[model samples]
Target chain A: MKLVRIFFKAVTMELSRRMAYKADFIIRCFILVINSIISPIFALILYTTTPGIPGWKFEEFILFQGTLIFVFGFTHAFFWQLLSFTIYEVRKGSFDRFLLLPYKPLSYLTASSIETDGFSEMFTGIIIIWWAFKKLGLSIFSANFILYIYLVFLALVFHYSLNIITASFSLIFIRSWALMDILSSLVIFAKYPASIYHIGMVFFFTFIFPIAISAHYPVQALLSAVSYKLILFLTLSVSLFFYLSISLWNFGLKKYKSAGG
Target chain B: MKKYRELTKIGAKIALAYKFDFIVSIFTVPISIIVFYFLWKTIYAYSGLDVIRGYTFEEMVNYFIMSMVIALLGWSNIERVVEYDVLYGEMVLRLLSPVTYLASLFYTEMGLKAMSLLVEATPIFLIGIVFFKAKVFSILNLILYAIAVLFSIGLVFLISFLIGLSSFWLKRISGISRSKKLFLSFLGGGFVPLTFFPKIFQQISEWLPFQYIRYVPINIYLGKYSTFLALEMIGRQIIWIILLYIIAKILWNRAIRKFCGVGV
Candidate 1:
């Protein structure tokens, strides 16, 4: 609860700082919104040209893309700055400042760093999801909606864990920004329907890495196509992943011999 | 030219210094190819068609590979560099240098891309050849492709330099650069082939200089155009390059005046 309050306060401060550069902020957000919509737009173009990823209609695919974008936007807004700043500070041997702070280093770092463009991406995702739901005649007040929300929450947890794990690498490697690109390559597999990938990839995305938790299963929950067994497994896996990430952060922190300036 | 050559060497050395980062980045291209391969493979199988929009599954994969190549070749971050220098007052230091600013940037970018060609693009091209049997090795096609790519590099540099020049007026050009990048990738057929675009977009793209950036070069490599037609496309690229060079010069003179007037 305290951490959440800190996160909100930091977010408010960051928002005000961004608003100080009104033109730049607005233009950056507008560009980000456009960037966020590219995947959905690509899906639309594909669907119009040919049958896109079997067993999925245009609107369904749009929803899946929207869900991925929303999850990405959420992570980008709240956690991505933590990863980059960790790398930057570690590289400059200035990361010990976090340790000197009153709060837990990871929690405080995560709370403080916020990106303004992410809100625009999140807004674009919401618009896309709403448009798709309208086109599909789906209601937002159903049991499925509750399940979708739960899964999306898990997805957020999954991304937060991933960010922590990646940021922890910076403590050890000192220049680990390239690790984020690998995460991007892995996470992109979830941008489309899992049916399009090989069965092995689908299994890997669901159980092992579980990037599909960010989009695929959440969309399935909304479509009422998800299985209880998969949800049970996702819940366990995401919990384990989060545990691993925190454990890794502790390990990296212990291993840290600060590059003292 | 001698100073520019020295600058290029320095740029290449800087890229080499980031070799570890480049190695990790190499993983990205293959993963992108894998995703495109599976997605298109499923699309073709479900549609029960051998070809859609003049692309077989193999051809489509090859198109993506060539698109990646063209993208690497044409990539420029001069706008961002310019933005930084302008906003941070580093432009004054760069102005003390002997070589022209944009020329120095162009050569440096070329050197960076040249090294990346060896580190990144070559391996991806090889993967296309070995795995997808991408037939992009015809002599005539290769010649035209090289010429077109040269023009593409110039065209991209001028466009980015012009965007950077706008910083003198706007004070910040990150949004412009980002928008230009996203728009170029989409409209230049980097994301999808122009053949798959709607009729109106296809017609609109024909008139845009962007198509020459990725689409025309890749298509020439794919032998989608005859030798005469490929040469004609290269001619169009040269015209765009010349026109853009003119515009960039005009913009640069005005931007310098603005900078001087403001005492920046």
Candidate 2:
């Protein structure tokens, strides 16, 4: 409860600081929206030129993309800064400040920073999802909707795990931003439907990295019923992944050395 | 010219000191290309077409591979550095320097590109040609492509310089710079072939300078244009460079006056 209050306070301060520059803030949001839509627009071009990835119409594929944007936006809003802040502070020898705070470093860092631009991405995603849902004539009030919500929760947990893993690298490598870039590049695979790739790739993405769970499963739930066995597998695997990530963070903490600013 | 040469050497050294970043690109670039390959390969296979919008599957793959090469050769981050400089008052020291700021920047970028060409771009170019069997152009066409690329480098630099110059007025240029990058990648045919775009988009792109940045040079390499047309496009690139240079000069003059007025 105390952590939640501190997080909200920090977010409020961050929001107020950003809101001070009205034009800059607005333009930043607009740019983020543009960034979010570029992939869909490219997909539009692909679908126009040729039949897109088999077994998926443009609208359905768009729902997949929209779900991806939403998941990524959510992760970006809450956890993206933790990676950068850890790296920058560690490199500058200022991370001791965080350690001196009367709270756990991980919890305090995660709660204090929020990426306001991510809200624009999330807003754009909701619009795209709504548009696709309308076109597909899908009803919202179904059992699958509840399942979709649960899967999205799972997806967020998965993303938070990934963020923590990267943050752990920052503590050790001190210049692990490229690792984040590589991860983002790899995540591009999840933007497409799983049916298009070879079975090997699908398996690798699911069991190994589990990036597919971020968007693919939630969209799958919306479009059709997801199997219980798959859900059970996802729940267990993601929990294990989260556990591993935390272990990595603790290991990184042990390895941490002050730069002595 | 001597000072500019020294600045270029400094830039090369700086890029050399950041060898890890070059290694990162070595991995990131091919990963992007691989993703494009799989996506397009699946599209072609499912559509049951040998060619879409005048590009065979091989040609399409070659196009993206070449896009990566051209992207590396033409890449510039001067705008970001400039924005940081202006915001942090580092521009004051730069303004006091004897060499011209913009020319210094151009030379520095040239040095960095020269290093990238040696360390990164050469290997990718060789791989695309040898492994991917990218199109082999005639000597005359290769010369024309080089000329087009030189102009492209100039055009990209001037555009970025102009954006950086805006830092004099705007407190932050991240939004503007990112928006520019998004448009450049999309309309410049970095993302997809302009031929695949709708007729209206193609027409609009034709009137803008964006396509010349990536599309025209690659198309020339692919022999999509006759010799005469390729020359014409290079001519247009030079025209755009001249126009942008003039705009940059005017902006710089005004920006300098503003800086002097503010006594920074």
Task: Report the number of the highest-lDDT candidate.
Answer: 1
TM-score of 2: 0.95
DockQ of 2: 0.64
Interface RMSD of each: 1.4, 1.5
What tier of docking accuracy does candidate 1 attain? medium
Candidate-wise lDDT, in order: 0.85, 0.84
- For candidate 1, give the lDDT: 0.85
lDDT tens readout by residue for model 2, A1-261: 788998899889878878775666778888899899988898888888888998788998898889888999998898888887887788787888988999989999888868887789899989999999899998889898888889999999998998889888888877666777776777777767776677898887777778789888898888888898988988888888999999999998888887622
Q: Which ten residues in a row have the lowest lDDT in candidate 2 chain B?
A: B255-264
Which of the numbered candidates is closest to the native, going by highest DockQ? 1
Runs in model 2 deviating more than 4 A are B127-143, B261-264
Q: Write the per-residue lDDT of candidate 2 for residues B54-139, one digit (tens) a residue.
A: 98888788788877877888888789888888877788888789977898788989989889888788788776777667766677
TM-score of each: 0.96, 0.95
TM-score of chain A of each: 0.94, 0.94
lDDT of 2 at A77: 90
